[model samples]
Target chain A: MSLTKHPSVGEFLAGCEEHVNPYRPARLALCPMAADAEISDVSTSDTAREGDFVILWGSYTQIFGIVLKHGEIANNRFGNFHHDEIIGRHFGSRVRSRRGGLWLALLRPSPEFITQSLTHRTQIVYHADISLLRALLDARPGHIICEAGTGSGSVSASLSRALRPNGKLYTFEFHEERQKQAMADFSTYGVLDVVVSQHRDVCNHGFGEELKGQVHGVFLDLPAPWAAVPHVTKCLVFGGKVVAFSPCVEQVDKTATELRRSGYFDVRMLETLATNWGVKRQDATKKKRRTEGTTGTTAAQEAEEEEPKDVPKTSGTGEQWLSYQMPMRSHTGYLLVATRAPDGD
Target chain B: MKAKPTLGSHVVLRDLEGAQKVFLLSSGANRQELRMGKYSAIPLETLLSCPYGAILRREADGGWQRVRHSIEVAEETVEVQENNQHLAQDNSAQSLSPSEVRDLKQKCSGSEVVEALASNSATFASKTKFAQEKYLKKKAQKHVQQVTLLRPSVMELCETYYKQSRNKVCGLRYDYLSSLLCQADVRSGARFLVLDCAAGLVAGAMAQQLAGLGEIYRLFRGSYPEKGLLELDLSESEKSCVRAIHLEALESSDPWSSEWLRLPEAPGDAEGEAIAPGRAEARLTRITKRHNDFKSLEAKAVDGLIVVAEDADLCAEVLELGLPRLSFGGRVCVFGHHLQPLAALQGAWRAGNFVDVRLTQLFTREFQALPLRTHPFMVADANLCEGFILCGSKVGEAEPQEAAGEDSPTKKQRRS
Candidate 1:
């Protein structure tokens, strides 16, 4: 279940007949997981097979693993699941462990699940920011997008999904080791065909001369995104979008100014805050009696009467489910979105 | 190259006051017109030749003229007052009367009118630089009859509908819609079962993402709602991807044999007028396409299921019928305005064959980033609650042995 045993990018590429363009149907034909079936069938099917990746979701934990090696096992606190049990099962099937008898649901790998379970090499973009970015960038089929400093490949996975079937993503990361790891992860996740991860500091060298005026969108998750604004303009086609994710307001100000100065129109800044609500059943009858008693009782007597009691036996009909907001991360980062206008307007 | 608004294509006209109106750019007898305030209505034909994002201003002669270049007003750096304590509250700030202003507006262009008003304000010289800019911008909004033509993307369309009528779009904020799409992993070549009660906005948004590569089975309660969908400038291929099916057809024991699956006959010619031959042919073609799409959907599992209904009970019923058709690991996102029903749904779904069940509420705050003044907007929407979302992934039904062991200690722990 460990990625350490997976083949390196060079080794994996050497085994392929030609370069892999994940968007092309021919490239998917060469994928081992899709070899036994047509590309469309394999991509759309929910059944897990050998060489396919799956998420083992337990009550309190989630583990990502590949369905390979006949006798291999996925060891976790809940149980130890054999790969054989997972290979032929549907993605949402619950499989029990051999010895512990504990069970976990077998899930199909998605970008959101991967974001939660993937090994973190750096702070990664969560679901909220990634969703907004995809929408604002207009990432869709046939689009070619560029991302700088592909930290953790969190956003990359989503962009890859957004540009599925034919589009391409050229991602740049300055850290050599992180870039290699991200490439391996993408390969494992079956998105390497649509993504090209490279080791380059885009702020210094730019997104390569070949990409000049070719990309439909550019995304910057760097510390100083303003430094790459000029480079973004060169690579992005006229009317293309550019999004910068910055944690601080000062960075947004500088980036917005730079984008406007570079003739980008409709510069906007927004913060997405998402809160999870906890749903619990509240007993209705007890609450009515308590309210009636509280009107005449003294404050101290009410406090004494409110001492801990045994867990109430629920009368299902009288129970009501209520939701309350749970504590959440107040801030992730600011999303600054702007579109490049036609030149010399 | 920028995309131009073709004849008969829909475009959004945004006025300087931030109000928007959707117009079809066409010429001849079927031409459309946009009312410019209480005075003028300009034919949309004047915008067919302009590219998206082009700005047009109302001339003094009541004709629409395209602005070739955007005028950049340079801000003069002046010593500004820290507070407005010295400013007088008298209502005699403007030297010109309302009648005189009206006469000026009728004789001069919008910018000229704004300039005259600014010059006539007796207190304009003493106001802070920011206050002066705000005053000018407000005045310009009132006087300027300028409208910017924009392409109808989901973001623009959603904002327009949201501002005009929140209920029409089910109070779906743009961010929430985006989040739902992402959570559902909507993309090209992916099939989705969508129950869109939001005037086809959800289906249109998904069609944009599908980009003609996948299928969208738009389940409707009755006749299809195409008001929001028609506003989108989708190519023919993209339009083909959306297939409208009656909800009754999906709920029937055998959808193929259901009467609801059959296309209704075209309405009888009213007042003895004959139906156009071309229109009859188009109706036949549409019905045949729907049948084909329904057959294809029946044979395969969808990648995701999305239900946007005001009634939580309806959402639950649809989910129950749709879950069997959803692929394993496929996402289910149901949106409702009230939290009570969604919370009840959350409790019920956790016991079913689903994983990663969550109820989420989103809050989005926009900030105005300026060179010197960057802060959150002072005025907020009156309705703070956008809606609640219940999301989960469908799993396979438990096997016999797993069902037997469901009452084990682990099950008790989960409930606790």
Candidate 2:
């Protein structure tokens, strides 16, 4: 069966109704370029048109770049691909290189894909931690969330998608260069409407006075998350959540103690490890022949002996697919989750 | 920001021993009672005045009281014996009899009862400081008649269900569910087709994350299973976004035909009793709505497809029927308890023009991050296999002849 036809970028954008938020400016005003060029939903778009960022995925490599500017070539080990060849193609298309006859899948940009391909400014959060963080923080539409020390903006991108359409993410980064790079990446990724990047140290200056008691959740990825515990207590609403990502158990101990001291209840710490499995199909004939050879019997003899009942009969196609866990990251960091106490307690 | 628990809504009550149960706070005539441990049932109405995270304790008079102070044990350097060598495991260590303890519980508060039990213990004073604290904490968990009221969210609901009744939710772990949501790129303002058989846990979670922004078509085989969805604290608008469609209706060639739209005859009409006009009208409206929801879903491609079935073959069948309805670049994720069934779908996905196929199993460990006690929680079956997730991205069609020949080279390269 042929693949289902998808709505074009223009049609999809036309179908979207603007949702106004009183806490922030109008959606178009946040990104002026979007007003003129119309920022496509990179996370859901099917076609990779001009000015859209896409992922060129090879067998063992992935290159992320913008499809704008004519004649811009994406050079990789696979081959060189012109931006002109990428535009007007549906995402997940296998396009052949101009000279090398090599092919790569052109994929639509998504937060998960971006996390795997983005340039690292600091230690980035992988999919495992990012997924758990969304659940722990209860990040959803119409909620205001605060994230500190936007190291590489990978987690910010993922969180921005979770808080899209009406929600906002106030992300603070201490380093100037990293903040600028993250802002540029956010703009490229078409999530500037949901993310507001600041170049200040939240651990020192706090998340501003206006945000006090307004945020629904706070996430700290700082070296000293306990230093910002007091600020989180002030900025979070009653019954709000705060999560701290620390690599060391000592950090978690200090952070948990500080959270308890600040009247936060139900403090929990967890680490998630994702095990990837490799699936391979085992041929039935090869296994049978190998077993026959080991038994010092010819194939014909083994076939005749099958009726004697000691030989095991392989079921189904005998070409069974098996999965085994591959080597994975043993440790990432500890996620400390706690809820703010109710008002007056 | 301070959203209090409303009447007729569900809230999770976590006891001191970390056991959680969801309770519906009904009002006036429909008020219910919550039974905790061996104590008497407490009226659910008493919890109406408490805030979301307020801790409630049972008083000596058998009334619930909100605890204003923190419940953490203060850390102080107490004069302690060198070790727990003086402590004995003999039954004589506790001087209080079972009948006497039961009597003390009727007259004293939970803390007072704990204090009396500790004082009657012969070896409690001779134990080290750490041992003494652990002993008191263990005793408190048993004697305390307290629970913290938590607002119901997807996280709390999933954890509560996984802990209390794993089979009810199809052994779906919260972390795996979270990974599924992320991998599928579930977000606001997107349309998703969900086929959830896990007591509506998956459907309810997507609705919670959508938060009144997107549309969810919950497909079911027979009667709808909405226990988990009803337990969530969703607004009227949010609940309205989730529409249930019968699987039979999807398979019908003409959903709007009269044959499909004809209402079922009312049962027990032996006396030719006339059906109520309002009830008939309601049934007609429901039938029309079901057909109309399917028609609208057929009108456009959905952004994502999520299937959590009891078996892998059913998951494969659903994916086959759902792949055509999924938009280009849309994600497809299937949940199963075993790997063989999930692995068997790899060929089907490859043939169906899906890319980036991955089979992932998550292993999570919870650590008790306390001073000098930082280690993974030591418990039997703490790391049970939650389940497996097989996910891929649907893409545009490839030339049939070239597609068959194009896969081998990449497979060989990846192998090398």
Candidate 3:
């Protein structure tokens, strides 16, 4: 083929190549940052207050920050930061706690920061599950993801971060209030720029099969997940991944049966658990010292030292102990991951 | 030939594509067929043995719907599996009527007769075999899954991050009052910035009358990646190119300080690129690298740089230094929770901040889409660990700011 003989068409093609996609109005929006915009800083001691912005860290070095607005503290894994020195700091300025702790002040808060923190009326997938689920599904940027029971929009928030700018999420929740909350939260988190929440119920009305195909992934967390399997099969792209989170085994069994019968391939049920840990100075006598100070010492120690009975040894010599396991969000729900079966036997 | 439809039989219908057609019976009806149809649909669900095969159908709309299939019927008893496993294992033999036995034996082939006899005596044996096979397949899948997750050592993780480090900063944030200890050994030489998501009240209280960190240096604001770009009217290729360029610009800019990476002073002996004759090549390279690292895509808004040029390097350094210094398990917290500004940032980057590039299968075309931030190393951990860590009274009691006296050090001085 002559390379340049078709000059006009070639030029037109080249011009077309340089053209940028027009802004999408339906499911997504693109918002550019200040050339000096930052990712926002997240750290200890400096709590991010309500109406403040913050970033979320995840596996694959994924970073998403959002500003806080409404919602209780239980929704986002990064509990609400209503007030803190780091709340309004610039990208590079240090966000240190009054306790003299240091923090990396990265990018500015995300638009969805508050949305991600909205309260969930239903059993919601917390932050840990969000990261793990994305990893398990190999969900990449620009992949279409589906979520049912948008519950405060937390999972949707994470999914929006995973699918941003070019990706779209069609989230469904039967509850109007929950949907409103989710939408508001998504707006707060900036994830609203790419998400759609509907007031339809998958179990009753069915997923919009005609409107959606090539759905890259699906997340189901509903009361009767089995009832939605038919719709799930209809909308799920071939070989697409679907994850169902349920707390009970019976639910898993029913859901599995439906999926298996529907010919969804490779469904595996699993769960996520995270334990809290405490880091403190370690010394041999740390335990003994804690016991001595708290218990006010024992006769054995006094006998060994041969100290006067009346002598009060207020100073416990046990090595300074600095460790304890804080309460952790140990159990959320069991996860069942399955793939849509390929065509033909 | 049509297989005889029996009551209480269970069946499923599918099209050639294997997609389930209408869940109907050989009788062609729903669960309420008994009331709707002249003849009630076979109640296959309750039957121990179903004689008819499922149906398949096509519709004018396009995809296949439900019809019916041909299946042979026999008196031979066939075992059933439930829950992908044997539901029962009954070995009791109940003699059938002589006439019924003869009918059963005559109906099936010799092998089927044996199968029927065996099924009657030990119901789950046949189903058990099928169940066991499925179980083995499941076990194999689990093993493969385990192998996939087989994690590398922390050093390996660090090295992976290092290899992917276009920008040398990792920020972490956590809840208030969670054990706030940073592990230097684990993050030595790494720019691990840490934040406490609880800074609002807890950190504010801890700061007391003293000026807080935010008060001292509030520079660049954070911008969140916006969702909903897939609805744009642009062609798939255009969307992708814009997305890639936007992402590149985002990465090239400093993630922490609202600035882009700057080339180190060339005079230093450290690894440095030579300055371009008239161009800030070194600086440009740094900028490009930062762009590459903070790759983002936006559709609705004007595309442009995220951070001001002057603040790029300073922000980058602060992010680089602070993140690593914080102990392992430490977290970083951002305060603003609004989405408008972040959405605006994404819009600008998409419209003007980036140069179009070549890409494929990157932009979502067919279905509702979402934007995802990809990094050379790995994605960020989305599990914000700070949410639940500060739940109890410890979070309530700390009040570090209120306790800290501006002029005095009343704080307990624990020897490190």
Candidate 4:
């Protein structure tokens, strides 16, 4: 893997030998800041070897790279990082450039890293939608699930993580190119076995007998979920669930009507709206403070509180908290969930 | 085969009358009947024996539709405007007396009753199709046989408490809680410290997110932790991940009081000294090991920290004990009812031990989605905790900025 001033991403990814799987997405799993863990401790059995898919994450930035032999260079705007420095080092080790002017940690790749940083082929599902669907569906370990219209493999990634250790996800994308692209991503992230992608119309041809009447959950991100309802009904087990993610109310209306006749009960439509706040530690309260104080996130508010005005300041006090701010996401879309009949068993 | 809704299982009970109550069903306990009024106290037993999430109805009625349509009816295209004024202008529209309608219900289903009641109306032939549909929709609510069993999710639990007793729960908005979980970076196999305000809503969710794989220390106030934790309906493994600690005890030099460690009193033996069963000994061993683990935990750091405490004193203790214990890059999340505490926290973080200091307040308004008329609900917001939160991450001292990709490569790269 030579350091080209402008190396193609595909070329770089093609040469990688292995990728990180069984990852916990939200938090970076391994780093020096993390507890001291060997490479084997952080990685699955099919761990990153020479040419494995590894990411070089700086304190604030990340670059996907190949795990190659000594003397090869991974050069970016930052500097030239020699392959020799990280080839024998552990996955979570912090390595510096040849001159030691810059530093980055050799870290494993997560699905989120692939989703947020990878190139997209279509409008993908958001993390909020994915997690909410997982929660609403009560996807448990060993629950086999089906997903249609795997647009950009965004939902596929989270599903792969959510049903880990035992479960598997059978995902389908109608378009050949997109399905092939998703397959590439699954391989890139080392989750090929966990998520099975197919290039077929699940609505026209029901999920073959391997999945017929046995899936724990089904997610439809298609245009006409009503058209797919019958196929999904045949695939879902007793008390299984189907969630149709439609942007339009009219689609939900048709889907609901079909589900009413499809022997599914307790069908309801919901819209997921998630909000993220900033929570941080302030300096420890320096004094026994007064009881009542108005709260605001303005300069004047902080300046107004020079002292508690009633209590004396002290040394060696602990930290305070600030819990005010705006959210990271707004409404995603309306989600409709319906359960198959319990008596069907 | 799956087990029925057991004593410890969290169940959302929908009585025959159609009111839903969410709670943990205890066996052989005198309690409010699931079907209400004269339904007997065996509600819990019956519910446990039945299938989980099965609707339990008091009475069964699969009646019929008897419509008198002897007269020839012409097909008419009649569209009704909403709340047609002319229909409401006149009175005395029904030929059947009230008792006659009740008699009809005894012999017919709600749809049948709607048909009979409509056919006998004085203005039945004069009304529009939409009006008739609306009338039938309203009538169905009164007669539909529905029940609720187990929808033990965070959303259902939040709504149940928010409507019943707002103060009894933390009142954290559903989406806001989800976002907090995401920001806290809560995941399986991640060690965390959680301080619950009142209802253990946050604490319970964290246990689920961890899925019993990691350690979870739950800090509570008063003598015991939140009773709402029962709402989580934790299995044996999920419950094992949770440890409830008195927040006040953290201030004491020996946080582990003797009370926390005292084994359950051994049953009296008249003739000989009784050795504790292996189960009891294992429980003691777990408690003792956890005690020592907590002692050692004070010396190291965890993956993340979450604080939902509203008490000013408790908030301070949570931060004092939680912030330093977070490893670098670990998330710190605080959810409260007001904005002041969160804002004050953001200001304090100007010292820059942390980065990505974010503050957010989330309020959600639901919309009624009908075929033609879709609008915001009259009550725009649910009775929710004035959900204000702040989340950020531990960062080592700030790194020097990279201007852009435009910057020339380092000199060392050329030689290499």
- The number of the candidate with the highest lDDT is 2
- Candidate 2 C-alpha RMSD relative to the actual structure: 5.7
Per-residue CA lDDT of model 4 for A1-345, tens digit only, reads: 011121122332333323223452322233222222222333332233565566665432244545465568888655688786667554434456766556554544544445555566877666556656776666654568899988888888777765653567999989999899889877766566568899989889877778887798899999998899889978887767898888888888778767776766666776654454443444544534444555654545654454333222222335444332333555556678887766412
For candidate 3, the share of real interface contacts preserved is 0.00
Question: Would you list the C-alpha lDDT of every candidate in the order shown?
Answer: 0.75, 0.75, 0.37, 0.60
Give all TM-scores, in the order shown: 0.86, 0.88, 0.41, 0.71
Per-prediction DockQ comes to: 0.27, 0.35, 0.05, 0.13
RMSD of each: 7.7, 5.7, 21.4, 10.5
lDDT of 3 by residue, B6-113 (tens): 333322322222222122233444453421112123333422132222232222222222332211111113544345353443534334555765686445433344
Q: Is candidate 3 or candidate 4 better by DockQ?
A: 4
lDDT of 4 by residue, B1-416 (tens): 14356665667655434455676675446554454333323345656656554655433254211121121112234443445556664568888888998887677655577677778887766766545555655555565444556566665676566556666666665566665676675655556888876587777777665555556778766645555567767656656666765555555666665555444555454412365477667776877765764654554355578887657667767788677556544578887776655556665553344444556555445444434434455665554235666775654332234224322322222110
Residue B214 local lDDT, model 1: 65
Clash tally for model 2: 0
Off by over 4 Å in 1: A1-45, A60-67, A282-319, B35-46, B68-81, B254-257, B262-288, B405-416
The local distance difference test score of model 1 is: 0.75
Candidate 1 global TM-score = 0.86
Best by TM-score: 2
Indicate the worst ten consecutive residues by lDDT in candidate 3 chain B.
B357-366
User: What DockQ class does candidate 2 belong to?
Assistant: acceptable
Comparing 1 and 3 on TM-score, the stronger one: 1
Residue A153 local lDDT, model 3: 68
Task: Summarize candidate 1's per-residue lDDT along A1-345 as a digit string, tens digits.
Answer: 000122222332233221111223334434332112222532533456777767787752455555455789988776678888778766567777887457777876778888888888999898888888887887876689999989999999889877765678999999999999999988888787688999999999999999999998999999999999999989998778899999999999989878877777778898887788865655656663344445667766775444324323222465556556777888999999988775435
